[model samples]
Target: MLPEEGVNAVRVVVGMLVRGEYEELETLTEARRLTAAEIAAAVRRHGRDLISPPDEAFRELGGVAVPREQADERAFHVDFPLWTAQDGLSDLTLGLTVAEVMDGVWTVELDGVHAP
Candidate 1:
């Protein structure tokens, strides 16, 4: 579920978030993109670990499709709801900016992780 594979990229990124896999998370960030890095940094700063959250936390992996203008067909947004029950860190939706690089192929990148 690599971020390069946009289909299940959200789930992979969420897993990385819970497991504190900084390097792996960094790899998923879009090249030269600072937003993703900042989000990762904020999550790390909190030092919250759920250990093993319930399966329900990941039930919303596909995310909500966001409408885009005709000229912006190459890229679009999807907000994936990520549930959590841990103290301090509650549930949040991961905002993903997906880009259709070439034809059917797409790349998923973290736009932001925030409370919904």
Candidate 2:
């Protein structure tokens, strides 16, 4: 779950998760790409502790499949707004470890979300 991988997963899930709410055109513009620095900055600005070290936890989870037995559990949960230049805003739940393994078991819950 490097930033790229996490973002990719989020994009896929978000698209599937929120398909009818927004048009295809709107969704494309909402796919935001965030750098590691940008992620760190947001965490700092929100006064939230880094759930796991920057790049460390995600790097470990990348390509490592979680066991099916614990697929329902979530290893990490992120509470933050996902920023995009065009569509403006969104929120994301970046599932790490077990949650990622289940593929679609965990649902992203966003409040006052303008876009998926």
Per TM-score, the best of the predicted structures is 1
Clashing pairs in 2: none
Instruction: Score each candidate by Cα lDDT.
Output: 0.57, 0.35
lDDT of 1 by residue, 1-116 (tens): 12335545555666776676656666666443545458667666544543444655445434444555655445556665554546533566567677666666666677666664
Runs off by more than 4 Å, candidate 1: 1-5, 35-37, 45-47, 50-74, 85-89
Error of 2 at 79 (Å): 3.0
Q: What TM-score fits each model?
A: 0.57, 0.26
TM-score of 1: 0.57
Alpha-carbon shift of residue 111 in model 1 (angstroms): 1.5
lDDT of 2 at 40: 38
Instruction: Point out the worst 10-residue segment of candidate 1 by lDDT.
Output: 1-10
Q: How displaced is residue 11 in candidate 1, in Å? A: 1.7
Tens-digit lDDT string for candidate 2 (1-116): 42354445544534432332233323433423433344334334443222222333233334333344564644333333333333334243333222343544432222222223
